[model samples]
Every structure is written in C-alpha cells, then in structure tokens.
Target: MSETADTLFSHVKPEQTGYVSGGLRDFFLYRDLGVAAATQGKVIAHLVKANMAPEKGTGWHRHEAEFQIVIMLKGWARFMYDDQETLVEAGDCVHQRPGIKHFLFDYSPDMEYLEIVSPADFKTIDVEPVCPIPDPTPWN
Candidate 1:
C-alpha cells in the first residue's frame, strides 16, 4: 500500500460489487467512506449512505457476521423488523443485531441514511435479500 493509501478517501464505484437489486435502484455502497487507522488492519468503522427516492428502499435482509447501526440523516424512513416497525426520521438511530431479519422503507423523495458498521470487515457478512413488500400505490 502507498503512503497515502490508508489516509485517502477512496472512491468506490457501485458496479464493483455484483450485489444489486431492482428494489434498491438509487442505493450505492461506498466502501472507503472515511480514513482508517494504520494500526487497525481492518477498518475501525465505516459508513454506508443510502439515497432513496419516494417509496424506494432496501428489501428485508439479514447479515450473518456484522451487526449494524443505522441513522437517518435526511427525510424519513420506517425500520421494519419481524414483528415491529419504527418510524425513523432525521437524527434518529436504530441498532440491528446480527442475524436478525430487517429492512428499511424510505417514504420520501430525499431519504438518506448512514449505516455505521464496526470492525469494518464486518461488511464481509453474507446479506440475504428476502421478498419485498408490495407497494400500496399503483405503478410502483
């Protein structure tokens, strides 16, 4: 690695990962959202920003190895778990344990959220996408 390799804000293109879905068209994952400490071989922490339009969001999914904390940065969203739903808006945060089934719903046009995962290699977890919820609105 170069001298600045660990300090630079590297750009991660969306196409680099084969993980894509028709339901999350506006979402993208930035692997290098911030700089990592040289002492930590794995990222100490990382950010995942999801930009969603009205009624666009991620499908139900679970991570096997990574626990995640999500914070809504803009607009509004609904966090759906197996038996409960919580409305999360700007400044709201939610913690999701690893291996639990969960999903996010962006009901506004400018919905954006940040997912901070610790021990950043936690992202290597396998994400299994489940069936999406049907939209009540026509033409979705």
Candidate 2:
C-alpha cells in the first residue's frame, strides 16, 4: 500500500465530538481538533471552554514545549505572564514563549479559547511565582 500526500488532510466538524472531562485542567472542558493525529504528533490543537468559575486558577507553571499559542474565542481571561498582568479577551491571541512561567487566575464563565501547542504530549511543571498575583474579581 502506498501512502498519498492527502493522508494528512483532517477535517473536524463541531458536531462530530463534544467536550469532555479529563483534560489538563479540571475546571475546563476540552474539545480535540484532530490536529495531533494529522500532524503525526507534531502538534496538538484543541478548544478549551470554561466549566466552572475560576478560583485559584492555574498556578505558576511552564510547559515543556517549543511553541504554544492561545486564541481567545469567547468571553475573557486574566493571566499573569511572568511579572505582568495580561488580560486576554475575545479576538485576542497570546503566543506564550517557550517555558515562560505564568498563571491563569481568572476568567469569564463563558470563556472559550483555541490552544495550539507543538508536540502533542507536553509536560507542565509547577514553578515559583515571579511576583505576587492579584485577587480574582468576583463573578457577577
């Protein structure tokens, strides 16, 4: 059997698969975009939506990957990138540098975003905070 170049083609419809638990975070739901298999584990793409209100948020941690980007699709989110407080809202994109320690402290209830990362399997290691994080605003 010969493999064709079109074998890499991948199309995922929103109705095909629904969000499920057991993702990297418990407070969020993930929807796989089938990019990892199409790219042969070279990359992974998925949509993450908020499942619960942000409380403690993702502690200071850095991923062990070469590239990572988060595109906010709905609502808004607040994160601490190193010593800076970065607020990413809809229509905003964040290209997190390799191994940059950060914390996602808060977000809206309808928050949803697209996340693409190099290497399907990446490790997240918790690290010490570079600066104090501000308190999360109460969700109305």
lDDT of 2 by residue, 12-43 (tens): 99999799989999999999999998988889
Estimated TM-score for each candidate: 0.56, 0.93
Q: Model 2, 113: alpha-carbon shift in Å?
A: 0.3
lDDT of each: 0.54, 0.94
Q: Over 4 Å off in model 2, which ranges?
A: 1-7
lDDT of 2: 0.94
Best by lDDT: 2
Q: Which number leads on TM-score? A: 2
Q: Which residue pairs show collisions in model 1?
A: none
Query: Model 2 shows how many backbone clashes?
Result: 0
lDDT of 1 at 129: 53
Q: Each model's number of backbone clashes?
A: 0, 0
lDDT of 1 by residue, 30-93 (tens): 3344424432534433334444343545566665445567777776666667546668888988
Per-residue lDDT value at 94 in model 1: 83
Could you tell me the TM-score of candidate 1? 0.56
